[model samples]
Target chain A: MTDTDSTTTGPLGPDDITADSPFTLPGFFDALAEGRLVAARCTECDTQMLPPRPACYGCGSRAVTLSEQPRTGEVISYTSVNRPPSAFEHLAPITVAVVELDSSARLTGRVEASLEDVAIGDRVELRIDDPETVDIDPDFDLSYEEEWPAHVFELL
Target chain B: MSTAHLIAVGSSPLGKTDLPGRDLFSKALAEAFEELPDPADVVDGLYVGAQSERYENQIMQGTLMAEWAGLRNVPAERVEACAAAGALALKNAVRDVRAGVHDAVLACGVEKMTAGGTEGATNALGAAFERALEQRSGITAPATYALLARRYLHETDATERDLAKIAVKNHRNAADNPRAMFQQAVDIETAMDAPDVAPPLKLYDCAPVTDGAAAVVVANDEVAAELQRRSDAVRVAGIGSAANNLAVAERDLTFVEGANVAASTAYEDAGVDAADVDVAEVHDAFTVCEALLAEAAEFAPKGRGIETVEDPEDRSAGWTDVRINTSGGLKARGHPIGATGLLQAVEAYEQLTGRAGERQVADADTALLINEGGVADAHTVATVLTATDGGA
Candidate 1:
């Protein structure tokens, strides 16, 4: 469980929804940039949500706490985007996968490998990259999303 | 409680059209109001379903569509749930009519998807997925559904060839449909040899980007009787919808549980069972979806949905005799995103009233429609319609 003084854990009220709270996107990405992958672990039902939110989807509870996530997970499913959106056309045929992290919080991200190399159950580790390093078209990024980082997976 | 009746339905030609979004809506509106009285006399309110403003760079579609329909003011608004926006509009209209809020309401949907070309359409549709994770990873509509398709294949005895046959079947069905975007039948070899849009999903497996519109007029029983004969009307017997997990990874990979809930709810509300449905038009954005939805809607047994391509007698024992996607589904009839769900209703209207010319299913008195938006069942709307004279 997350024990950092900077992050608060437990059910949040309306007053606790500030940008600084890990329940918000800004705080979640901020932690990721600093090498801390945080998820909101629902205390009531144990649902782990990546990009920590205020409530749990599992049991619809707001009684969630901050939980630092493990980097390694297995690929739950995999596919390749042969004709991607305009912003990512530069990276056509990008192999992407739905990965369940070691803590059971699942998310989707690009896999750093060819489609042929990746398979379901392949062990992979999450790697955070600065948004600028990814070379996504600037036009695709909304003004508020310009500074956000992108996540990718590398086969272990 | 008032009974909601679908009095009339109409659609613009489905394909890459040379019309603006409003013009497409006008075409549908004109066709819908053709046999009925003017919109000013027949309807009290309007709901417009539109997926994105990116293509036309416009919002306020509710006001725009209302004005075009010559409706001055009576609760005009827009409803959206990505591709399921059309059915969402219809649901709201039915609610209004059933609750005595309006005697008649117009539910319409429009999309000019071809305006942006392939890349622009791709970018616009990309907004439907969970933005923070999936979008950043470069996922598109086909790609997200491909994720579902991949896991489905891994767990089932179904093969890639089985998926190809779904395309072939829909194409063959489309060949007989006058309103289909693709009117020609394709062989299994052609479907199998098509270029891959995403692994496990080929070009043929994906629905085309279409420019189209559909309009449905829902009214109370009194207004329906005033407008048309009882035999010509179809009853909105039941409605159900669900919003599942936005992120693809978080939800069940194969079951499409949300769709199941929606379908089951609609069946219960309609006082009918899956076996009683003579025809169905489901969301087939991808070939795998047809199979997935077959099971979700309880028309086929689990892991045996691929038998959708076979004859009813040839399917597994647990499967129902419901005819799936007789309008060629989204695969060939054309998926105009915002207009798709209403298009399904249009086909149902045709079948239930005995107007579906060549592709008609015999004694198709009861019909089901399942429209979904986002990755699989991130949002779903299931509706059951029965002919007024068919024992409803």
Candidate 2:
């Protein structure tokens, strides 16, 4: 598995890369690798942010740190783009969704796998894709665990 | 505050123009001023609305316009607020006159978007987005609207066909509007099948990047009455503005909260409801925006705006009772950012005064104009104009 193989599966090119390439946040990526999730907490505002920003969107203060998040959260909303922008032309019919982190912040990312299992308020977990071994970038290749613990949905 | 009436409104034909922003604005201002009985001596103050100084690398637009339009040395002020810059300038000018600070004022909005290349113009317009996040995410205005359109489709029963109707209707209306940038009418098939710029949104769904300006002279009752004695005058019944979070992620992506708030404030101030509005000129920067705005402004219920348009009564044709975007809106009229809000006002005045010609709604007595700036619903201005004089 190499970057080229990942490109065959995901959306990326030789020059296409993420802001975070060589450096990877383990706690963030490891959780996804283990089918869990994580986010960053602003020490000042106590606000949680996903796709983690270095600083707080609320307080604008740089006093922020990372935290492991629960695997399960409600899907606040979702949208399926039949046609993506030029940048994402290779990845059409992509489902972009916002999952409300239990602590308050919301995580926006692509929802891979089947659309039938996904619904607003459905519980989902982080699912990571190994891009280094493949041709795609891990950040763009990551997805969500569609099968939820029965209790997660039954509890609601 | 004393009442201020929009006595005169004017604009250069909107399109791809070789003229500079200042020159375009000056031409519109000249037309507006010349419409006044005593053009040379009437204006007591001038207000100019501009979204960015980076585009032209200049500031103090009102002073420049004042000088260029031959109304030199008048007190001039510039207002900036994403796309709603023009409406904000008008509000400030109206405030001055209503406060009796200035008997008469000229409010103008101008943007030379095409002067800069597409990328440069996009960068300038995208400045309204949350700098750190949007820049990192690389979400341009179209992308932001695309996200909304996706959400809208997900939550509602509306289809691509419904959104295409908005484009078709606006373009058809634009065909009759001499000032519209794209006067060519497009059918639903052309709009729906157009090439996609963003997912679920096509080229026809978006507004053009235009260089244009719109100007209006607002005056107090005394001045308005004097102007009325000589010519027809359109009165401003109410004005309202609202602000919201600048990031699309921060907002309820399903709704434009800022537009809702602005509409409530304007309707309340005007002592009327959405039903009273005979015609509307809304900020339809994108087709989905127009649909979402129709709901947000209380013209229709949530998730039912598509139904409203589909309803025979809600059609854009005459006798529809409530005509929305008769001037083609931003889609066909062009989105000259800074000038859009003031252009809405101009449209309202034209409709109320029965000067919209082929696109005029029959017996249009009250009109509503909505202008929004930024991707995150940052700023919204909603104004209600009535045929009746505000002075009385």
Give the poorly placed runs of model 1, Cα more than 4 Å off.
Answer: A1-7
Worst 10 residues of 2 chain B by lDDT: B130-139
i-RMS, each model, one decimal: 0.7, 6.9
Q: Rate the local accuracy (lDDT) of all candidates.
A: 0.92, 0.72
DockQ, candidate no. 2: 0.08
Residue-level lDDT of model 1, residues B1-392, one tens digit each, is 89999999999999998999999999999999889989989999999999999999999999999999888867789888999999999999999999999999999999999998998899889899898888989999989999999999999999989999998999999898888899999999998898988998999889999999999999998999899988889999999999999999899999999899999999998999999999999999999999999999999999999999888988899999888999999999999999999999999999999888888898888999999999889999999999888732
What is candidate 2's lDDT per residue for B253-355, written digit by digit as tens? Answer: 8789888999889899889998788888888898888888888878777876654345446444322347788888999988888899898988888888778
Docking class of 1: high
Report lDDT (Cα) of residue B336, candidate 1. 96
DockQ of 1: 0.89
Deviation from native of the Cα of residue A58 in model 1, angstroms: 0.9
